[model samples]
Target: MTEQHAFSSKVLQEDCLDYTPFLSSVTLARRRAARLVSEWGHPDIAGDVALVVSELAGNALLHGRVLGQLFRVQLILTAAAVRIEVGDACGERRPEVRNPAQDEKFGRGMVIVDALATRWGVVPRTVGKTVWAEIDLR
Candidate 1:
């Protein structure tokens, strides 16, 4: 009799998009995030993922932009969840969840991120910081 064996493998899926510090970058980032989420086999959570990406990328452009520097958006897909990260060149300005006034138009980005993300925080680097948010698809 011949013995038979089964083979299995695990692979990590990840991608990144770099953008200039232009205000229009936020729109591009959100669009790309939605498309990538769908392409990464998570169409079910594409809406939430895209919204989070918009907030994070908007925050980076509004608060973390530095002259002559660029920002990056990264996505990591795991078995149970997806992680999104936005890296910018301003380390001093950190993200915070603020309750804006009724008439306020801004200061709500972090609030939205906090409400949707399973977990989110900031990661400081040598020259800047990366704000990351994770969404559970399970």
Candidate 2:
């Protein structure tokens, strides 16, 4: 099932998907984000946007899992850019690049996000924080 939020943040279109903090939810969020962005007429960036959502959602599940709390994945698309936001229930832990060694098997999600997105950052919310990335479609 899918649900949307009542938001009017900008001139462009927005879509939101909320899910339980589970390992499988990350893949769900990624697929939803790709479909939404493609429907919004930005198919070229669907893969990147999906990757960003996966990374953020995976982080939420792995690091920000709060009992009885749900996370959110939001996509905002416009003529020039597409913004993806993933909100989780943990606020204390912030996202950063660890610059792991080349042989490390993990710690590359955010690095991939940084390389794919034009800009990305985290915003602290009342209960948690939202990690967002914007990709230029121009």
Candidate 3:
């Protein structure tokens, strides 16, 4: 679903989708995020937004999946930035960045997010947590 909010006279556009906790949802989330960003007149940041969405959604699937619970992806757009948020039911399992060996094949999602996003963090919810990243449009 989509909604528009007004904050300090600026219109903030938001789109949210919930996905079943599955590996396939990661790809879906990435594609949807890219399309929404592009459609909102920010094609230049779509690629970066997609990458961030992929990482966050993948991390949610891998680390935040709870039985029978769905994860949510939300995109918030303003004049200056776009924020991507992934919320899952497993709140206790927080995400952390790992420095893996060069030969290691896993563990670099947050690093990629950190590099691309201007800022990112976790927000605790009553049932779960929302992991979010923001990319500046300037």
Q: Which stretches of candidate 1 lie over 4 Å from their true place?
A: 1-11
For candidate 2, which ten residues in a row score worst on lDDT? Answer: 1-10
Candidate No. with top lDDT:
3
Ranking by TM-score: 3, 1, 2
Q: How big is the positional error of residue 25 in model 1, measured in Å on the Cα after superposition?
A: 1.4
TM-score of 1: 0.89
Per-residue lDDT of 1-138 in model 2, one digit per residue for the tens?
Answer: 012323344648888879998888898888888888888887888998999899989988888889999999988886667888889889998777679999998788888888998888888889999888888885
Clashing pairs in 3: none
Which of candidates 1 and 2 reaches a greater TM-score?
Answer: 1
> Higher TM-score: candidate 2 or 3?
3
Per-candidate alpha-carbon RMSD to the true structure? 9.6, 5.7, 4.9
Q: Record all residue pairs in model 1 with backbone atoms less than 3 Å apart, i.e. clashing.
A: none
TM-score of 2: 0.88
Model 3 root-mean-square deviation? 4.9
| The best candidate in terms of TM-score | 3
Off by over 4 Å in 3: 1-11
lDDT of 3 by residue, 47-99 (tens): 99999999999988988989999999999998878988899998898777789
